[model samples]
Target: MPITLTIPDGLLSPTAQAEAFAALTEAVLEVSGLNGNAFMTSNVVGSINVLPREHVLVAGKPAQAAFVELKLPEIALATPEAKRTFIEKATDVVERAAGGRLQRDHIWSNIVYAPDGAWGIAGRSYDNGDLISAITGSAA
Candidate 1:
């Protein structure tokens, strides 16, 4: 029951991305009732995508978009109800981070549970260095 949350491109700035990352982490803790340290200790991974040439017009103005995709273990999906619960909770976190400018439609997500633990990590690394810098707060 691994869930992946994909953020839209250019939706967040560097500072905003950092804040969103922290906010998302907090949201997960609140919804899952998991300890912060323990949750951080887990192998949760995230990637951010920035489309420099990508912009959307809102109120006749151009705005940048950013995409963030997160992958978590399927252990959260023990039952159908659990899967629904996770999706609902996870999407809530994402929506909050997006500040109403983004929604489920703006992003794409996938949840897969496999006994052999096959979630393509390398395949999902399409964000280049922008997202990595946002996640790590280092120079890209």
Candidate 2:
């Protein structure tokens, strides 16, 4: 899975930005019941894009904002409750990182699911079964 955290420059201090990204990662793993899973931990990768303030927009106008997007296989965060929990936790991570510089409403989050057999790693495509086996360290 990959989590992309896009934010306006200066929305968070450098240290806070790093911490928030780590926190967001932890939130997703924990909510998905994969916390402490070495395979999942290593696979949970992401990027933090800090763009110019003018590039970040809301209502078509430049604004202070953050976007957290998680791209994963359909098998992850499959439950409604898990989705809700992640959204909530992700929002909190950004809010806390802002240190009163940003608002919850200004932070947005979304999850995009890759179709079965489409998710890939190391140049090889992985279906849902392949992912499960890899995550569990067992044969599919």
Which has the greatest TM-score? 2
lDDT of 2 at 66: 94
Candidate 2 pairs with clashing backbones = none
RMSD of each: 10.5, 1.7
The TM-scores, one per candidate, come to 0.50, 0.96
Q: Write the per-residue lDDT of candidate 1 for residues 22-71, one digit (tens) a residue.
A: 65555444444453444232435454444444344334554433333335
lDDT of each: 0.46, 0.92
| Candidate 2 lDDT by residue in tens digits, 91-134 | 99999999998878999999999999999788999999988888
Q: After superposition, how far is residue 117 of candidate 2 from its true place, in Å?
A: 0.6
Name the best candidate (by lDDT): 2
Q: Residue 111's C-alpha lDDT in candidate 2? A: 94
Regions of candidate 1 where Cα sits further than 4 Å from its true position: 1-5, 26-33, 36-40, 52-74, 117-140
